[model samples]
Target: MSLQWTIIATFLYAEIAFVLLLTLPIASPARWNKFFKSKFLAYISGQASIYFVVLIGVLILCLLDAIREMQKYSNIESTDHQHLDAEMQGNMRLFRAQRNFYISGIALFLLVVIRRLIQMICELAGLYAQSEANFRQAQSATVAAKTLLEKQGAGDEVAKKDIEDLRGQILLLEKELAKEKKDKEAVKSQAESLNREYDRLTEEHSKLQKKITIAGGDKKDN
Candidate 1:
């Protein structure tokens, strides 16, 4: 109740609040759900550390100020030193401080969350590979099935014709696959080349536009 004790209490509570802020929004099932893997959370942890360090720097300054105040009044032995008490009371608990820290920590988490989202995007890249793998497996199975069918009807003219038909179909499939591969490569290459040319032309056009503007301005001034 005395002034000295009140100041001390304020300082003590504020420090406590700061600490609580760092630890809030603790690890939870929902937090884990936010990220698909441990690495994502780990990245967030690193950012949280940075934010804590920064925010903590301010809190530390407050602490140092509290200490400086103590020193300023240290010589005043006869004074009640009640200000220290008020500071202690104000700085002791950190529930309020923790709220802001948690907010910053969550914002930093978004940086890592974006990285995770990118990884999710990269995962889609494997779809093309999986499709190719499936196609190969299916082709292999088809050949196996055709082989079995031919073996069962060996020496029959009708079976020979069926095998030849299957072979022709398989050849067609192989050709189509090759064509698609060629087309994909060609398109990709063309796109890259076109992009390069577009960039160059755009730069040139920008320069030309600047020159035209300058020339027109001179004529108008004349």
Candidate 2:
């Protein structure tokens, strides 16, 4: 093979290796994202568009050349039937042309495939990051809700305790009020009995004074 064909063959092999590595499950999406974002890859990516166009142009030219060679050799082999040596040479050349055609064609196809694979990997990485962020937000919200519920529960317990204390105080006040009523009734009954005794003594003293006056008047007359 010529030096140029040899280089193209090497590039094709490299492309195959890249495809295999890309499809393997050796690295996660995050790791692939990191690798793609690295400084070296970033620098390469800056010029990747230009590089891709140039490489495609080269491949197309090589494919065209291979096709022309294949047609030329096929014609020669068919027309020059009497010259066996020339026919053999043409056959060999045609075989090389066909080989080059397959190589360039496959390389071009793989190039596009690799680009698409990279894009898919990038999109997958973005989705993974977004999902992780959403999961973290959900966890934080759950924690916050739990904390709020706990606080409300504590407040409810405090309110219940206060109500119980107020109820106990009310019961004590009612008992005190009942005791005060009993004391007032006892004092009222004692005052009524003292008033009755005073009336009876006054009536007896008046009757005794009237009897003495009558007896003295009779003695004076005798």
Candidate 3:
């Protein structure tokens, strides 16, 4: 049981680190994009933030239960029940870590997460705009490519114009693809940050639950 939590803690930390490092920059450009522009993205982020808040509540309940159980276990055991004592210590550490973490997460959700949500909406909006532009460009390029084919043996002007149009279309697509990739990276970064916050919350929740169990146990014995 102890080892399981240790593993969870380690994994959650790494997840947070990876996400924040990658996503925060691309969407940072307020001029390039404006957040809250995409209602869908904003809504999704809001839902996620709320989910975390609910999770924190559940953790509190579980924590109470664990503390209660611990009380009984601690009192009923023999003097050598050092195992219970040690486990109790471990549980305490988990609880403190979680309490601190979730508190921080709540702050972040208010500030960073909400901000990120806006950024995501903006990014999506930008991508949509870019896509429409690309479609128009592609249609124009297709017409050029067709005109050139119709006058296959025509002057250099016809051949050159066709080639130029095609080249422009390809370049435009490349730029669009690149922009799309950047947005994906930005999304990844946001996910990573959220994941970190999630881990912290989960750990804290678990710790509180253990305490609640222990506390309940103490009550029962008395």
Candidate 4:
């Protein structure tokens, strides 16, 4: 094989190996995403579109050349049967052309497939990251709710204590009011007894004065 054809064969084999590695589940999507986003790959990816176009164009040209070579050799083999040596050389050339055609076609196909696989891996990694963020948000919200409930419970306890204090104050005021009412009633009873005693003393004094006046009148008449 010529040096050019050997190099193409080697490139075709490499493409096949890369395709197999992508299809196999050896690495996770996140790992693949990280690898593709690395500095070296990112630099290569920056010019990936140009590279893709150039590679595809070269492959297409090679495929067309191979097809033309195959057709030309086939025509020569069918028409010039008298020259057996020439016919044998033509057959070998035809075989090489066919091989080249297949190699180029397969390499082109695998290139597109590799690009699609990388895109899919990147999308899957993004989805995983988004889901993790949502889960964290949910956890934070749950924590906030728990804290709010704790605060509300503390407020309720404080309100209950205040209500108990007010009830104690009311009980004390009722006891003081009852004691004052009893003292007022006792003072009223004492005042009524003193008034009655003064009335009885006045009546006795009036009777004594009347008796003295009656004794003096009897002496004067004697």
| Top candidate by TM-score | 2
For candidate 1, write residues 44-80 as lDDT tens digits.
7668667756755654554454455445444343455
Which ranges in model 2 have alpha carbons more than 4 Å from their true place? 197-222
Candidate lDDT scores, in order, read: 0.60, 0.92, 0.64, 0.87
Better candidate by lDDT, 2 or 3: 2
- Model 2 lDDT at residue 18: 92
Model 2's lDDT to the true fold?
0.92
lDDT of 4 by residue, 1-222 (tens): 788778777888898888788779998888889999999999999999999899889888888888898898888778847677777888899899888888878877887888888889899999998999999999999999999999999999999999999999999999999999999888888888877877887888788888999989999999
- Cα lDDT, model 3, residue 25: 71
Model 2: worst 10 consecutive residues (lDDT sum): 77-86
Q: Quote the lDDT for 91 in model 2.
A: 91
What TM-score goes with each of the models? 0.26, 0.87, 0.30, 0.75
Cα lDDT for residue 26, model 3?
A: 51
Candidate 3: segments with Cα more than 4 A from true spot: 1-154
Clashes of each: 40, 0, 36, 0
- Residue 46 CA displacement from its true place in model 1, Å: 99
Taking every candidate in turn, the Cα RMSD to the unseen true structure, in Å, is 43.0, 2.5, 58.7, 3.7
Tell how far residue 156 is off in model 2, in angstroms. 1.7
Query: Total backbone clashes of model 4?
Result: 0
